[model samples]
Every structure is written in structure tokens, then in C-alpha cells.
Target: MAKPRRGVQFQHRGSNHHNGRRPSISESDSVSEPGSPTGAAMNGKLETSKEEDESPPQSEYEKKKQNFITRAIWTLVMMAAFFTAMFSGHLYIIAIITGIQVMSFKEVIAIANVPSRAKNLRFTRSLNWYFLGTTMYFLYGESVIYYFKHIVLVDKVLLPFATHHRFISFMLYVIGFVFFVGSLQKGHYRFQFTQFAWTHMALYLIVVQAHFVMNNIFEGMIWFFLPASLVITNDIFAYICGIAFGRTQLIKLSPKKTVEGFVGAWVCTIFFGFAMTNVLMRYKYFICPVNDLGANIFTGLECTPNPVFIPQAYHIPSIVTDIPLPGSLHIPSIVHVAPMQFHILVFATFASLIAPFGGFFASGLKRTFKVKDFGESIPGHGGITDRMDCQFIMGFFAFMYYQSFIAVYKANVGDVIQTAIQGLDHEEMVEVVKGLSKHLVNQGVVQETVLECWTGVVGNRR
Candidate 1:
């Protein structure tokens, strides 16, 4: 009564100030004391969130360590996937190669597409992919016709494709070429032509080379697997050797490459190749040609091993053998080694000494474009092309070497069937079939009645 203190009067009326009524318990709790349980819990949550949001910056060494771990993990993952495809079947391996070819081509062309995009030339990109599809149709068609003629020629659906694949491929390419010419703008002659040449270059460097690698797979799994493994082994050992003992730089294009590492990797690769060949030679799944696309490691294949896989005795030259021995001692006069072991030395040498130049070439290419990598298709690995640069050259060499030195020049059933189907008329084919049936009967490979029935059928048709 004597007019309460101003603060006490305000506090008494504060609850009813909003609507002339006392405030609820929830409203009171909203302005609770700092020492209350709810206030302490709220403060604790804020601190927890702050701690979670703030992470200390990593040092250079820590960043590098993390990168290395990521790289190693991806490496293992790629290897596992590769082996799985290899063991699954030829078709699976072919699918993998095709995927790689497309991805690598995309990465290579994308570098040039940046300028085309800026210039608003959308057709430039379309032309690149058009050319790729055209090239693939030609190359894959050739492989199918050459390797599986028995099936392709007999199937009505596939016969036309097999016989005229090249023509069809050429027509497709010409369409793309005409479209490109029509799409040319007035002020962009030099840039358009440059892109044109770049597209062809990418086709040759990536698609053409990959086609030969695919041929190697059809020739035999070893031709594809061995060379690829050699390249990969050399790359791994080169890095290890470089880190262990490296001083002199091997090439200006690639500063990290060292002479010591190069030489060391050569030695290590040779040993690995020798050992790997020995193991692979024992499995027909690795040595046999792919007669069945569906065949797998478990199903297995049957073929006489290539002569190179067989052990042979090589007489050592006295002068060469005695040089490394003591004056009183002599090395063995003859050493037993598989011929493939000797060939593998050459492969290992190339994989170590020459194949790396492919990587250096890619390095030079990246320098020309002022880029760090071809693409980000693979984490830690950079791109398919980065991993495949050495592989393309190595595979090309393997294909050439196999064709030149290893492949036995002999006619197989597919070759005969292809020649017969293409070279003879329909009537002539019937006659040849009858003649072949009669010949088989004479040889006791077929019953004489079979030839009579075949002759009767042809006679009725005529």
C-alpha cells in the first residue's frame, strides 16, 4: 500500500501483462535459471555441436598419408575386379575392355570439348562419339566375323552384318563426316579442323590400339593377361624401387622417374614374369583360345599347350657361361627353361624400359593441355587412360609379337567356313556339302546312307 517498489510492481503484473491471466508452467520454464537441469542440458548440447563442427586442419604429411591410403585401397579394388572378370569368361573380359575403351575415349575427347562448348559448337561433341561408334562397329564386327564365322555365317540375322560390316561402318562414318562439314561455322575453320584431327588421333591412340588388345584376348587369354600383368608389375616395382633408392632422373617429361628405379624394376619384373608364366601355363583356361564366349575358369578348356610353354634344354655358350664363374669352376652346360621364360624376359624388358614411355607421352600430353589429369573417372587413379596408357602400348607389342613370332600359320575350321560361305554361290554350297558328305562316307567318318539322303535333298531342290 504505499506504492510498492517499481520492480516488485512490474514483476507482479508481468504474468498477466499479455492477456490479464497468470502464465503457465511451460512459459515459466522458458526463462528458467542458468543453474536449472534444463539449462545445463541445453549448454552441454551446444558444446557438443561446436566440438563436432570444429576439426583441426591436417598437416601436409597427414594429407599425403591419407591420399596414399586411398590410392592403395582403390588399387586393391581394381585388381579384384579385374581378376574376377578375367576368371569369369571371355565375354566378361571383352565387356570390361569395351567399357574401358569407351571411358578412356570420353576422357580424351572431353579435353577438346571444353573449347567446342565455349564456342557453342554442339555438333563437335556429337561427331566425336559418332566416330567412336563407327570405329567400334567396324573393329568388333571384324573380330566376330573372323573368330566366330561358324556361328555368324549360319545365322540369317547375323550373315548380312558379317559380310557387309566394313561397308556399313564406312557409310556410318561418312554420314558423321558430312554432318560435321555442314555444321562448320564461318570464323571457326582452324578450330574445327583441329578438333577433327584431335578426334581421329584419339580414335587411333585409344580405340585402334584397344582393338588389337581385344584381338589378343581371342587369340588366347595369355596374350592379353601376360602383357597387361607385366606392365602393371613394372609400374608397381618402379615406384617401390624409386622410393627405396633413386637419384638420377630418367626423363625430363617425368621428373619422378629415376634410372636406378628403372633398372631395378626391370630385374624385378623379369623375375615376376617368369614366375607368373610358369603358373599360368599350367592352366588351360589361360593358354587356350576362346572357342566359347561362355566358357569360364571352372568350366575349363582343352588345348595342346603352345610349344613355348614346354620346357626345353638350352646349351649355354662356354665363353658367356664361364665369365661369371670362378677360374676353377664352370656353369652348367645346358639349362632347362621354358621358351616362354625367355620371351617373358623380352616382355618384361619392354614393360620396364619402353612401356613407361607411354606414360611419359601421356605426361607430355597433359603438359600440352595444362591439366593435372585426363579425367576423374577413377578416384585416386585419375582416369582410365592414366592406368591404360602403358597397357595400350604393351598390348600392341604383345599382339605384334604373338602374330610375328608365336602364332602358328594354319587354317582352322572358322577360316574354311568363312571362305566357303563367301566364295561359293548357294548352289555351289549345296554341291560342296554333298561332296563333303561323300568324302566323309569314304573316310568312314559318316555312313554312306547320309550322303545319299543329302544328295536326294539337293536333287529335289534343284
Candidate 2:
């Protein structure tokens, strides 16, 4: 039951590489080191396993199923205290985000296919990483709540995304999962999980930090989809394009991916911008208002201010209104509205572009580690990291962009408001007394006093 020291890599590169496909030192091309029984057996297994490991079969079914299950589990975990946040319902969303952190941490363990170990040192290390991730995730949510209370800022940093919440929630739990796997007390399994969990977490965290900064551009739960949909879409389309018309391979690391596929994915992504934008818009307006953005209260039409109603120089009840004296306040301030659709496009487009890089990064990792697909635990998809790879990467990206482009975008849309008084004619200044008398006859939302003020300063001046 012992594994060979020279474990075969999933993908076979040519002769000089350690990928296990090369001919051995024996006189015969097919044979191994001379008289080395162990080496010969290793050679035979390497030959057979190479033929068997063709990407583990990237399955669309598995992908969609995982997505559904992940979303469902997240929804359930947050239901407990979502309503408990009371008026702070956005806290519920943060709770859900926390759940994502936990699940994602679990996903890393699943991806690396870290075989369970019984050694105490290994078990403890794995548990530590898990706890660290969770602590970070938990702190992230707290940090969000802290800043949500303030007026939006200049430098964006989401402490929740940068915290150890992921470790605390799931990394710590990984040890318990393997300890209960079986009664195999003879050997160790904890160390493998530790290495696996730590490796996966290390890679996924690049994404975690990215999300913490760009949260403004990514809005609502749609922030989740920014990376999700884009990366997944890129994967599917790129594969299809590569299979259909690829003529050139982009790199030796990911030989199957082609230049044709890259172009096709890019072309398709532009369209995704439109579809994804609309999707986020709907989600923001209805499904998930993570920022309390769309929640506007209507004061009713009963006492709505008339657009044309002007105030007089000495209006009624002016003393009680506590109106700022002289140059302190600007009256009749105007509100300028920004187009929501534009913001959506910016978010979706940027997500579509940057999210796919996570997959590329994974491809690079597979090449560097000299492994294929990270692991074979997930069936047809290699491992959890393989499946959730883009989410991890894009999560960081989406969070950062959402904060920058969208939040900063909001800032760029002017806020200072100026209200102006109007005059009636060229002769108005000479008629303040007459204007006051003229104001006495005005009616409706426009008071007689306002009319008197307006006559001196309305139509005549620009």
C-alpha cells in the first residue's frame, strides 16, 4: 500500500521534466533503473496513471450543482440571526458574507485533497490555519459595521475581508473532520490536511484582500456573482472555443487552453458586461441591498414641497425654523441623481475582465507544484479549490472594485447644492416696497411675501 517516492504528475510534459513520462536509466527505452525493482514498479505505475489523469473531467453538472449547494448552505446559515440584527439588516448580509468566508475556507481543504493525518503536530497546525482564517473573516464583518456608520471614505479597506474569520470558521474544523474519518489508528492523516489547507488558504487569500478594497464597485450580493458568473463563464466559453477552433497553445503550463479560447472568452465577456450589469441592477434593487442603497422612504404627498414655491425675505415662522443666518445656508437646494445603470456596467465589466485571472493563477500553481487540478476529491473537477478558484480570486477583486469604482464614482457625482431666489422684471430693485405690496396679493404654495421678494429678484436677473 506504500506510494512511490517519485509520484507521477497528472500532466505529462516531455523527457527532461520530473513529470514521470520520461524513459528511465535502463538500457531499454521502456524499462527503469537497472535491477531496481522499486524503480521499475514506479515507472510502470507512472505510465498508466498518466494516461488516466486527463484533467479529471471538467463537468458542467458538477459545477452547477456545487454552485447551487453552496448558495443554499449559505442562505440557511445566515437565517438564524439575520433578523436578529433588528434595524441593522445589512448586518444580516455581513453575516452571510461571513458564511461565505467559512465555506470558502472549507473549500480550500477540500481542494488540496489533504489526506487526513493522525500526528499531533499536523493536526494542530491545520486547526490553527482554520482558526486564523475564521478570526479574519469575523473581524472583517465587524470592520464593515464600524465604517458603515461613518460617511463613506477616501481610502477603502474592508477589515472583514482581510481578517482571520475564514480560519476560525472552517480551518479549525478541518482537523475534527479527518479525526472522525475512520478508526485507522495505525498511521497519520492530519499532516496532509494541514499542508493542503494551508496551501489552499494561502492562494485563496490573494482574492480575500483584493475584495476588501474594491467593495464599492461591487454592490449587493451581486458582488458574489461578479466573480462567480464571470469566472465560470470564462471557463466554459474558453474551453468550448479551445476545443472548437484553437490552433495555438498559450503556455506549456495549461496546454489545453488556446489562444482562440482566450479571444473567444474576451469577446463573450464584453456581452457578459451587459447581461451581468442588468442582473446586478435587479439584485441590488430587489434581492440584496447590502449597502441599504435602495431603501428610500416616502414621506407621502400630503405636505410635499411645491417645485415653484418661493420663500419671502421675511417669511412666516422663519424664527422657529432656525434658518441659518445670512450666508450660512443655501435655500432651495437641488438634488442631482446619478444613473444606476452606468454604475452597474462599470462593475460587471471590470468583474468580467479580472475574475478569470484566478483560473489562470490556478493553472500556474498546478504547473509550479507539478500537480494536476490540485486534487481529485471533487470528481470531474479535481478539488474544491479547482471549483471555487475563481470565486476566491474574484471575491477579492470584486470587493476592491466595488469600493473603488462605485464608491469613488458616487463621490465624483457632485454633492454641494445651491438654491437661488428669482426676480420678476428689470425694474424690480426700484420696487421693493411695491413688491412687498404686490406679494400681499399672491396665493397658493407661493405666499404673498414670497411673491414680493421674487418681484425684486426673479425674472430680471439670470
RMSD of 1: 6.8
- Could you tell me the TM-score of candidate 1? 0.87
Model 2, runs deviating above 4 Å: 1-100, 103-123, 126-130, 147-219, 279-354, 367-371, 374-379, 408-462
Highest lDDT against the true fold, candidate: 1
The Cα RMSD in angstroms, rounded to one decimal, for candidate 2 relative to the true structure is 22.9
Rate residue 182 of model 1 by lDDT: 94
Q: What is the lDDT of candidate 2?
A: 0.51
Model 2 per-residue lDDT at 285 = 32
Error of 1 at 212 (Å): 0.9
Output the TM-score of candidate 2. 0.43
